[model samples]
Target chain A: MNISAKQGERFAHAGLALLLLGLLPLALGPYWLNLVGKYLAFSFVAVGIVLAWGYCGILSLGQGVFFGFGGYAMAMFLKLEASAPELPDFMVWSSVEKLPFWWEPYSSLTVTIASIFLVPIPVAFIFAYAIFRKRVSGVYFAIVTIALSMTLVVLNIGQQGETGGANGITDFSTLLGFDIINDAGKVAIYWVEVVLLLTATTLAALLLHSRFGKLLIAVRDREDRVRFSGFDTAMIKAFIFTVSAVLSSVGGAMFALQAGLVTPSLIGAVTSVELVIYAAVGGRLSVVGAVIGALLVGFMKSYLSEHFPEIWLFFLGGMFIFVVWVLPNGLADLFRKILRVKA
Target chain B: MTFRRGNQAPRRKAVIPAAISIEETFVTFGIFVMQLFNGLSLFTILLLMALGLAIVFGLMGVINMAHGEIMAMGAYTTYLTASFIEHHLPGLMGVYLFIAILLAFAVTFAFGYVLERGFIRWFYHRPLDTLLATWGLSLILQQTYRSVFGAQEVSVPLTTWLSGAWEPTETIQLPLNRIFIVALTILVTLGVWYILHKTRWGLRARAVTQNRAMSSAVGIDTNRVDALIFALGSGLAGIAGSVFTMVGSTNPGTGQLYIVDSFIVVVFGGVASLLGTAASSFLIAQMQTALEYLMSGSMAKVAILLLVITVLYFRPNGLFASKVRA
Candidate 1:
């Protein structure tokens, strides 16, 4: 397609972004590369936050529910594959005589993949419809999401036989004949995850750069004014929230593939809140900034927990304070001066 | 943990799927009473935390996640006071808890004052910023506690008067501390209610809550009111923590444990209504206690939270929401 000079410049920036992403796999060794692959998965969730929180102004503290949903779905599929010719181990342990009919669909790779994309849409829609229809906004929405997430975690932990308990759905062996535990396999999955993350980021950028995106911001700033303008504000808010949830779910599914285990802890209150914090530190409003932020926070968590275990919490906490007080816009905004224009 | 485990008979029945006998029904009826008693102890903690939360979240619109840390500081203060009594003032060991409660209030009140002046003031009118900053402060406080006091849970030596239970019936024995806590919550709630309804400070606080600009215009010094009411809320949380030491052990992360639950209670009850908060905490505690007998611990929690969410769906403003909230 022919493009103008301004459009060409934008494409160049996108190309540069891809180039930087490409350089990462080359520079890092296999282990660090795999670790970064995990971070890249997290960026998928962060990118979702840029849309949900930054644009829609709906801070979903419970996105982990969708994340966990995608993860458990992926893990179930992998578990079914690994268990080939027998039922999953948890079901066996719990003395389940028959394979649960519900899990039958996951036996097919196509169903599993489709579910990774589809499950969160209905879940987000129902939740958003219930609350947003009533015009619940701001902190109340946050509390609702947090409560939902915590409920999912508890449900996962409690339903051990059906859902694999607190240890979660683990012992994944392969994904579509790709052995995930090997070093070569790790890099393969890492690339796959990185690509998915890039796709997610691109999707978020497209949404954020659209007129729908500006309307989302308007709803955030003045809901009454926007509603008075004859826009079905609830539908717009619900639609964005659903998209964000589905994005997070894909991230969670990818994370399950990379990490080779999906636990309820991933869907807990703390992890969900941390996702938001990473998005905030990256620049909540900027899609690319959030991806970088997730990587930085993930690196800090791993690096700090390794070298300075005791100081890690303080450091992360301090980062939270620093981001809030000194850099309200995040590390993303710092480069805004050099760019000399808003993205 | 104790409340969750205390009623094991109900748990065994819950795990057994579905079967009930006439004798078992009679026992279940008694157990319901027992669960209700156990619920009082749980409710006491919820009420204590929810009251302070109502003041901060409902009245002021601050998303102060560190409110739990303030409560934990109070618990730590009690632990310290009890230790001090046992070590230095050996003769006053019996009287230490009273002093501990008072000291917890003063310490947390001052801490809240400093926190407001330095950190909270900077983030005024920004709920999201306030939320993140307070959460950061919570992590810092939790780590500081871990550094200073170590990670393990510690119990304060209870005075003999506070220990032991009263057997009001053959199968039901209620812990004295829990009964005392319920009584204490009543006293605290009444004190808060009276202060909000009757006194000059309460008037100023209410005026500011209803309309900040108008309150300031009337020479009420709304900023001072914000700071004072916040400190009062923190101080109330401290007292809650002090009372909590009687029923539970104190640890660095204990605050984090209850922060979500406290928020749920306050929000589910209705943001600004003290009576609603009171009703919701009692209702939630009873549900949790009774449900624990029937399901797994996490499931019971999940069910209770689900119930709250369902309730919120029907009444998004909460059970007893004030009409004026933005």
Candidate 2:
């Protein structure tokens, strides 16, 4: 039934999302543009949530883990570039005369850039295969993913020699040998980030409108029925989950470039859950809504905290409760209401 | 676990004038025993927290994500009661500890009652939604605590009676506070077992848990049962918060720190079985302590998490899964 609506809705949503993406870089000032780029990076994870949670009924609270992996993968190369002829700062401080074995490969530009996609995808694929194949899902899957992110954060902090410990990888001067600290570099990274964010959402929209997407919804709603009808439900779930992880990894990578650092805090339970909240608030079922939701929440947080810092948590908490209990569909539903009234 | 026997035994011969074998064995045994004691104390705390979670998630099938914050509510109440005693009723300082535990339970029970009626009850059919909404509720409660108590952690003064330790052997010492917590866990476990098994309310709760429609059709007040059980679970958390003061300190964020571990315990124990939570909490806490001895703290945690994830993959229902129809 939704196959037809999804096809039309996909194009309509993609057009709106792309139009906003097109307008943002031209409309905003440099500071806000850069800020939006960070939020857009977050949208990468939100789009993942829409596909995995919204379409396939698999909620992962470890998107940050994948994001962190992607960012750190990129950071390793950049850190190596910045500190050429020497080991990365933390590794050096931990006191070895020579560079670590793992850090050696990241010195190459090809491996570093390829790792942004290559690293998170295969790791996510294996993880999804293990968990989803065993049919551990729903709240259990969420818990496992959260545990994964929390474990990664702890691992990063513990291996101060390799990953920079508590204070994550930083001091980046170049990406692909371009001076990333300067204005032009920041703008270049920001544009690249926005484009990636749009591309991810576009891909998500297309996936959701496809035949497999319809089957995903069926599996979500009635797993036993779908299984009885002869679907390889596990593979479908694993595929979607891996895709979500891929999207988050891209965001994490861009985030490192834009923010100039990647910290363990980015991959903690709090960050992972916050990403989920973004998707929920944006309208979990809609691809573009998740992206907009991430940006809106980021803006609200920065804006609200600046004016009334004390009240921001209360507001965030209230929004979480309101979105989950009252408006499960989020701002997208509200937009529909407004549009209906205007029509 | 330790591979120091051969070298250490010879060194003991040179260092000690007394029986080297006995002294050496005692020394090694003492360290392991202490870790075991510490692990047990950790287990007691996890059990207290997980018991509440097990009740709500296992029996009720509602994921109350605000559980840790609710536990914090209990801790905060204890902190407040402690302050009030210190300031106003100086004579009752020692006695106030027991009163504070009761107060914490009563206070959070009332809050839980209201919360169940107002929010959680409406979302019983939707477990995942309950999780998100309760998480939001947790944030609100956390901010509320910060606003009220200020951000700094608050520690309640220990009652003189519960402040000391007992040493059965010459080498091994067990703190009174930890023993007190362990005793409290036993008492609560018995109380929960009795409430869910022996009483009329327990029967109704069991009926509701097993088959809500049939039970309701046969004239059970499922709604009241739901509210009371939730309150009971929350009250248990409150008591845990009160006891938490005896062990360490409380902050607005105390509950948040423990909530994840509490969730892990509940899931590890197997949802729908109180016995499962008890067993899993003990296993997890002990494993954590034992691992810390072998590796760095963070790596120990990562290892434990990996182990649990791997275990959950194999036994998806957990260590002691209860048979139930979805």
Q: Model 1 over residues A253-322: C-alpha lDDT tens digits? A: 8889888899899999888988988899988877778888988999999999999989988997898899
On the 0 to 100 scale, the lDDT of residue B119 in model 1 is 83
Candidate 1 docking: what grade?
Answer: medium
Best candidate (score: TM-score)? 2
Give the 10-residue window scoring lowest on summed lDDT in candidate 2 chain B: B1-10
Q: For each candidate, what's the DockQ? A: 0.67, 0.75
Q: Using DockQ as the measure, which candidate wins? A: 2
DockQ of 2: 0.75
Cα distance off (Å), candidate 1, residue B253: 1.8
Candidate 1 residue B209 C-alpha distance from true site, Å: 0.7
TM per candidate comes to 0.93, 0.94
Clashing pairs in 1: none
List where candidate 1 sits over 4 angstroms from the true fold. Answer: A1-16, A19-21, B1-29
lDDT to native, each model: 0.85, 0.84
